[model samples]
Target: MPVTVSIAEFFSSLHVSGQVGVTREALLPGDSEQTQALLSRAFQDACDDLPGGLKADLECCHAAATAAIHYLYRVCQALVDRAMSEEQVAAICAAMPPLPTSPGEMFSQDLALRHLPELWSMARSMSDSDPLVTGIEQAALRFPLSSVGIALKNSPDLLSLRRHDGLWRLYIDRIIARQDALRLEDASTALAVADALGEHAHSLAPKLAARLALASAPALSAPSILSLHP
Candidate 1:
């Protein structure tokens, strides 16, 4: 029998913080205009506290959402094939290119478009392993969900992009506690996605950053190997 995996199951495995129960809204597909629009509006609502007159364009928002979905699938697929080290994950995270600062720059910029080939080449080099894929398939049986909604919740990877210079560092810190699960690469995936989405993702970036800070705060205080060492 063939094994199957749902987005929710894959997503749940990404965090060792414990599953929050994936929501229907989080699983919405990103390819369609309607879905992208919906995502854009949802992000806009999430970031309403920002300055007035900032609007999210469809193209930019769609790109952002696509990037998130793309990286999420790619990294999980990679994990399903081979176990990755913290350094390997960090290397992948480093592949994410920074976005142009303003919305106009994002829309007009070809830098992201130019970098697609390099990303594809990097992914191709990773290839697939049957045993790991099978394992992931078997694990997916316990967390199945219909494909009607989107896969990720709050686009945690993209959400982290709103933070200061500490995004990857913070993830590294959290992963010390969560290890093999919570990864700097995943945060980079989110950052790249939001960076692709440009102004569209920016509105929600601040809120996302704040939420991450709160969630990771306790992990610092909890007893861990890092604290024991120094």
Candidate 2:
């Protein structure tokens, strides 16, 4: 079975001390339930590594981590703080690899930017929406090669889409299309999107889409965008 989680249990699992729980819970906007669930699962897995029979200490550690995770979620919430629904997270995770799997897996993997472009690109809006993920990007440095490769090739279209202003257009069609004919639900796509976006894809899609729409332009100027993350 998919180890699904409930909002209550998710929060409880993180609150070892029961102290951070109430405050953290109090600040949360109800729309963040899904991200909360994701983080709860992540911390729960992290706590699983406690040494043999150290249940007491484990609880302590779990609570602290839970608090941190909760705090992190709160941070993510305030960043964009918009309503990024669970359906979005599930849809994204379905195509991406199992999220880090554990705490060590979370930060220890040393994942090369070369590995996760699609996920990264997809996360762009999500990341911008949630500062937690954005901050994580700063520390995690998520600029995979494939994402960069795709972004650069599409640069001309990107620049032409908008001259000097730093506006980004979000192309729902292109986004959906890129996910077509390929395994968007796989590890490669995650890595691919990140790779393609590198510094460009993730940051610029919104600009391109919005600008072209404003100018009443035909499909994006350059065909390069199509070739990316393909």
Candidate 3:
């Protein structure tokens, strides 16, 4: 059975007396219902003041964590029941590699690779209004291998898509420029390229914003923005 944690108990567990050196054991002098009630009321008041959106986000994060814990618990329980050897368990675990990039990616990969219906169901409970969460859900729906594309015979420099016969046909759009760089005619071309990128321009927004905001800003210099990556 799951243990229920009361607000008073939760606060008592903190035991943050610092220099006073107050321990959790010292907090509870006796079984005082009034003290517990007061602590619970204080906790409720603090929670009530928090923003609704933030609270919802916290709840969603909690749900995802709980789902992951449930998955790990089941895996451990199954291994123990089967009396699997330590080496066998290690070998099975070795197949699923970890991604240190982000937690969102990690959870999405877990849901996809484990094929956990309950985990996905829990994730779907969160609101899809956020783009970050939407990206995660889309990733979870597809197989992990599908996300990790197979090796290509030839690496292409550019990919293009055009509308032909009411269908979007994709093709390679390659142009060899002088010294592999775009020689902009004027500021108009630069502005046009920036406009075409749209939201993608925000990728350098932080760096640009920081430079502009500096008190002793250095002379401005433009970098090649038309570079393509594989």
Which candidate comes out best when scored by lDDT? 1
Backbone collisions counted per model: 7, 36, 0
Error of 1 at 212 (Å): 24
In candidate 1, the residue pairs with backbone N, CA or C atoms under 3 Å apart (3 or more residues apart, or in different chains) clash, namely 27-149, 27-150, 27-151, 28-149, 28-150, 157-190, 158-190
Tens-digit lDDT string for candidate 1 (119-199): 333444454333323332222221111000112222232332233223223223322322222222355533433343355
After superposition, candidate 2 runs with Cα above 4 Å error: 1-60, 79-123, 126-134, 139-230
The whole-model C-alpha lDDT of candidate 3 against the native structure comes to 0.30
Ranking by lDDT: 1, 2, 3
How do these models rank on TM-score, best leading? 1, 2, 3
What's the TM-score of every candidate structure? 0.27, 0.23, 0.18
Deviation in angstroms for 114 in model 1? 25
Worst ten in a row by lDDT for model 2: 161-170
The RMSD of every model to the true structure, in order and in angstroms, is 16.3, 17.9, 19.4
